[model samples]
Target: MSQTRFGNQIKQATLTPFEKEVIDGCLLGDGTLTKSGKEYRLRIEHALKDREYVSWKFEKLKRLCISDVQYVSNHDSTRFGTVGHPEITVLRQKWYRPVKQVPEDLVLTPIMLAIWFMDDGTKHRDTVDISVHSFSEQSLHLLQKQVSLLGIKTTVNSDGKGKRLYILKKSYPSFKRLTKPYILKCMERKLP
Candidate 1:
């Protein structure tokens, strides 16, 4: 999808208050609905800095169960100041879904498999790094803390190399129902 088209889709897609604000800030300006055409970095930074922003977006996206969020990069610099020229191409937000079945030899949980799918999917593999190392042990710890804070009960393996594994003792039916929207929200908050 073209950048303009993707931007339009973000504008038209149903979003939470936080999602709307972030997208609007990126496509438009902070206080205006008119397209700024150059605020991608600023908007992304703003959204990431706000804790509620990312959480809200993630929840909404997971609920929607959207396969991806596509957009284009208009900036010339990386978010981390790397020497890279941003391409004016589609940016996809790949969603993670638990695999119902896998080979018995592979000791992986549904969540782990889902995360793998999101990172390995051809559409986003080149654009985003979803590798196991990318997940980070620190991030997993943070996720565990967050999940606890949110009152979501699950058993997470405390020992792991990079991304720790989390196994829900009592499966939440609601989780399946909310996966789409939750993922979308996550992308909104996490994506630049």
Candidate 2:
């Protein structure tokens, strides 16, 4: 997953002359103006679109690799990110139930937990504050349970119509703490 290699590979791929000129112009930060430049600009846009398509292709490849590793290692596979559905499945496999139960102590990092709140349609703030529409008593109880697991204390307010708001007691986790590098290091190593 080296950017340099990826860049070289892209360079090696056949490209229209217009695309090459546009890419060159873009790299030089030269605004396109001439007739060929305009065409180059269009080609650049096309290249960008193609790049996005390629990125998606790579993502699928990575997922497949992860899945294969999981299968060989007999580990669980958990998928995160807003771009895809959330699920935990058997390693190297399409969605399947785990042979072993996930532990209750296995809490999501703060950043990952944030997704749950967002999915519930709550607005979160930097000040550890969250606002949400009315909740059912069951929903409120569930929210409290999850918050407790995250070691976060929350103060709740109700508007008497089941409407509730909660303020988090701690700072949001820093991006560095939630980054992939840190997370991968923390995860149990896959069996070789």
Q: Report the lDDT tens digits of candidate 2 across residue range 1-192.
A: 674455334334444443322222221111111222112111111123133322332243332121211111232222211111111111102201121121233333443333223222233445333333433454455555655665566666764544444545252343223322222221212101
lDDT of 1 by residue, 1-192 (tens): 775555555544444554333332222111112113432211121223333433332343332222322232453211211011111111111110121111222222233322332322112211222222333454445444544443444443333444333424343333233333324343333222
Winner by TM-score: 2
**lDDT score of residue 111 within candidate 1:** 39
> Candidate 2: which pairs clash?
67-92
In model 2, the Cα lDDT at residue 75 comes to: 24
Model 2 / residue 115 / CA error / Å: 1.6
Residue 80, candidate 1: how far off, in angstroms?
19
In candidate 2, how many Å is residue 123 off? Answer: 7.7
Give the Å error, residue 43, model 2.
Answer: 32
